[model samples]
Target chain A: MNEYNSLLINLSVFIGLLLIGYFVGGIVEKRHFKSILEREEKLLYFPVINLAPRRLVEIGEDLQIENCFFVSGLVVIGEDYFKRILGFLANFFGGRLLSHESLLDRARREAILRLKEKAISQGADMVVNLQLQYLSINKETDSQNANNSVEIMAYGTALKVK
Target chain B: MFITNIDYVPSLKIIEHYGLVSGSTVRAKHIGKDFLASLKNLVGGEIKGYTELLEEARDEAIDRMILQAEDFGANAIVNVRFSTASVAQGAAEIYVYGTALKVS
Candidate 1:
């Protein structure tokens, strides 16, 4: 009887996780993507470049650095329930982990966009010499793997052109 | 204060150069956030909680660097660089540095 009860509890917990991952995680991802699209459209005018500005007129017709400052954006992303399961299955078969591609992609895009937004708020014309750094921060766990974090940092210099 | 990642600013001229200044910070997410993140692993997607945590840490580090530059009487910071490392299982250390300069 005890063994049967334990089995039933485990099954219920598994189902609960699946339900949470499917419903809650889905809503979060969809909302995040929608917001990203809207923000990107609004920020289309801000020009973010990786090249250093050598001449004042290169960026704009009459541009000069009125106030220069450093800007940085960081995000640490993780996989969702569905993606984690897919990743596990893929690992067993030894193939490409395509499930994780979008995770990093979102992180990179969001970080860059945030950096540009910050520069624009500071009355900057453009952001230059952009740098990207990636890090992984995961905790060790006894029951499950503790390796599930991707950190992205986007940084640049903002030039307030006048 | 002006800050640029390159060795020189576009229109500003470097009048006096001070030594390098730097700032660093380490941060981690709360246990509640960690629990959510682990569940997220089941259906992989963007982790907003972790993103916010790291963003906050980076901003704090930059603020500290700016304070140091102010102490050096520098009007701008140039040649900025960033480095990060995993200090623990779920924590990161962010280090930012730049050269302080009096620009005109």
Candidate 2:
């Protein structure tokens, strides 16, 4: 009976250690993911400032299409929490992961809408730029793997159909 | 992505049959442990703070610039460009711009 009791105590301690280890791993993962988020936050501006400019202007306007438009966006995610859960069960550990849309996607949609508004302001029926870009930047690192994020962008021009 | 227009416009003029031009500007700042963590990237890793803050500011600045361009009765903004300045230590200034024009 005493032997069985000792085995049970050892089992319990092992379980405790495993759980603690998992949490510790999670904290580290969270730290890494946090920095990735920060990097994305800054990278997004490049589109607005560097990417948004440089539109292609045609020497001649196309009469068939009255409006041209472009759009873009970005999404970033950390990792799979399921993987973490599995690790914990395996006596290893896991961490919390984050998921988010690419800033580029957010930027693109907003930009095109602004263009549409511009068309309205000019009293033009449509537009004609019709171009955009999207990209992803991954910056996640861990004992197992590295993670990154994606970004999207949209741009276009508006013109009058008549 | 292939951009068909410029972000910065040196100037704009609207004439009869002349298409309208428009633009926007934005700026943002990120305050938290995020910035400090990014510094660790000085060793040649990704400095996320620079990317995150720049993205927010650029987007907002562009929106503002675009809205202002729309107010000017511009159909499109040509030759758009962006500029940056330090409004404060932890804050950044992002400016999105393009020429506003009007076409009849």
Candidate 3:
């Protein structure tokens, strides 16, 4: 009877935590997506390119080349409890982990946006030769309960055209 | 000193070259911050602590690289590149490398 009661208690705690994660984590994720959308809209005009322009003279009339410098932005994003729970299950089944995928997507986009902002703040007409890198800060524990943190970085050269 | 990812500087000409200058650092997460991060992971958003950690590491590595370039009597570091790796559990390595050049 005692053993059964203990098991029941543990199960309840697990369910209770999951319920909290479901509601609270959902709200957080929604709010984050909304912010990302709004910020992206605000930053639409900050042009970023992956290739260096063939000729600087061919750039728009407004830009007169002055100087160029390097810029970078880094963002570290973590998954919510709800996503963690989903990831745990996905690990068991061995397939694409969508929960972690969305987390990385958000991180990558956010990092790029921040990089653009940095370039703009440096009086850059535009950013070129863009690059991105990602890292995961996952704890080494038993397979089931291990947690992972994802980080992304975006970098480029900002041209200060006068 | 000027630093850029591009090999060629539009205005400045490379007078001399100093091969490759590089720096790297490995960092381990603290237990306290790890616990806090796990808690923050529950509701999910940016982990400020880890972000700061990575930024600091990167800056340190870059600073070290600059120090090396200065020792080599270079005026600038070009083709600057950054890389990170997971050396061990709860630990990460940040590396920065570039070609040192004297420009005029």
Best by TM-score: 3
Candidates 1 and 3: which is better by DockQ? Answer: 3
lDDT of 2: 0.41
**CA error at residue A96 for candidate 2, angstroms:** 41
lDDT of each: 0.77, 0.41, 0.82
Candidate 1 lDDT, tens digit per residue, B9-88?
A: 66667899989999989987689988887666665566778777777777788889999999989988889888888777
lDDT of 2 by residue, A1-162 (tens): 999999999988757654653564346445655654565564442222222222323334334433333332222222233332343354443343232222223344444444444445555554444454433333333333222223233344433343
Error of 1 at A157 (Å): 1.4
TM-score of 1: 0.81
Per-candidate interface DockQ score = 0.56, 0.06, 0.70
Best by lDDT: 3
Q: Show where candidate 1 strays beyond 4 Å.
A: A1-5, A55-63, A137-143, B32-49
What would the per-residue lDDT of candidate 3 be over residues A1-162, giving only the tens digit for each residue? 999999999999888878877788778777887888998999898888876644444665444557888888999887777788888787679888877777888888889888888888878878878888776555565566666677887887888766
Measured against the true structure, the TM-scores of the candidates, in listed sequence, are 0.81, 0.34, 0.91
Cα RMSD for candidates in order: 3.3, 13.4, 2.2
- Judge candidate 1 at residue A154 and give its lDDT: 88
